[model samples]
Target: MKLYVNNNLLLDNITIAESLKIRLVGLLNKKSLNENEGLLLKNCSLIHCFFMKFTIEAVYLSKDMKVLYKETVKPWRIGKLVKNCTHVLELPEGMTTGIGIGDNIILEGEKNGKGQ
Candidate 1:
C-alpha cells in the first residue's frame, strides 16, 4: 500500500501495523527505512524510538485521515500524543516535508500499484 497527500505520492511500500504485537514493535530494531517506505500504526497516537537507530517524522492522523499533528522524532525520543488520533504514520526524516496540519491523507491500496 501507499500513502498520498493531496494526490501527491508520499510514501510507498507502507506496512500497516494493525495488530498489537506489530504496533508494539514498530520500526524497532530496524536498520533503516527506504526513502519511499513507511509504517502506519493503527489505533496509535504516541510512539517511542528507544531502540530505533534513526530519526523519523511522525504524523498523527484522525480516523478520518486528517493530519492532527506532526513532528520529527529523534532516536530515543517519544512523540506527543494527539487527542482523537487513531493512526500514526512513521516515515523517514524529511519525507513529510510540505505536509502540514489538517492535510487530508489517503491510504491507497495495492490495486493502484506501488508508489502511485
Candidate 2:
C-alpha cells in the first residue's frame, strides 16, 4: 500500500500490523527501515523505542485517519501517549519532514486485477 498526506505521497509499500504478535514485535530487531517502507500499527496510542537500533518517525492518527500528533523518537526512548489516536504510522526518521498536524491520510493499495 501507499501512504499519502493530503494527496502528497509520503511512502510506499506500507505494512499493516494489527495482530497482537505483529504489533508487539514492531521494528524491534530491525536495524533500519527503507525510505519507502513504513509500518502502520492499528489500534495504538502509545509507542516506545526501547531496544530499537534506529530512530523513527511516529505519526499518530485518529479513528477517522486525521493526524493527531507526530514524533521523532530516538532509540531506547518512549513517546507520549496521544489522545484519540487509533492508528500509528511508523516510518524511518526524517521521512515526515513536511507532514503537519491535522493532515488527512490516504492509503491506496496495489492495482491487482483479480476480476473483482
Candidate 3:
C-alpha cells in the first residue's frame, strides 16, 4: 500500500506491520529504507531503535488518522509516548518534512478512501 498526505503521494511503498511478530521485529536488521518506502506499525504508541542501523522518522497518529506527534529518532534511541495514538508510521529521515501535527493521513486502497 501507499501513504498519502494532503492528496500527495508521500510514501509510494508502505508495509503495514500489524501482527505481533511483525511489529516486534519492525525495521530491525534492515540495512536501509528506500526514499519512498515506509512501515506502519498498527496499535503502537512507542518505538525503540535499539537494534537499528540507521535513523528514522516516526509519526504518531490517532485512531482517526490525525497526526499527533512526529520526531526523528537516531539509532539506539527511544521514541516518546503519544497518548491516544493507535499506530505509528516509520519512514526515512526527512521524508516527513511536509507532514505536520494534526494533518490527516490517508492510506491507499481503503474503502473509506482515507486512513482509519
Candidate 2 per-residue lDDT over residues 7-66, each given as its tens digit:
998887788887787788889968999999988888888999999999999999999999
Badly placed stretches (over 4 Å) of model 2 are 110-116
Tens digits of lDDT, candidate 3, 1-110: 87899788887788888667778888995999999888888888889999899999999999988999999999999999999999999999989999989999999853
Q: How many residue pairs clash in each candidate?
A: 0, 0, 0
Top-lDDT candidate index: 3
Scored against the true structure, residue 32 in model 3 reaches a CA lDDT of: 91
* lDDT accuracy of residue 73 in candidate 3: 97
Supply the global lDDT for candidate 2. 0.87
Q: Alpha-carbon error at 63 in model 2, in Å?
A: 0.5
Cα-based lDDT for every prediction: 0.85, 0.87, 0.87
- The residue-by-residue lDDT of candidate 1 on 44-86, one tens digit each, is 8789999889999999999999999999999999999889999
Model 3 stretches astray by more than 4 angstroms? 110-116
Pairs of residues at least 3 apart in sequence or in different chains that clash in candidate 1: none
Model 3 TM-score on a 0 to 1 scale: 0.91
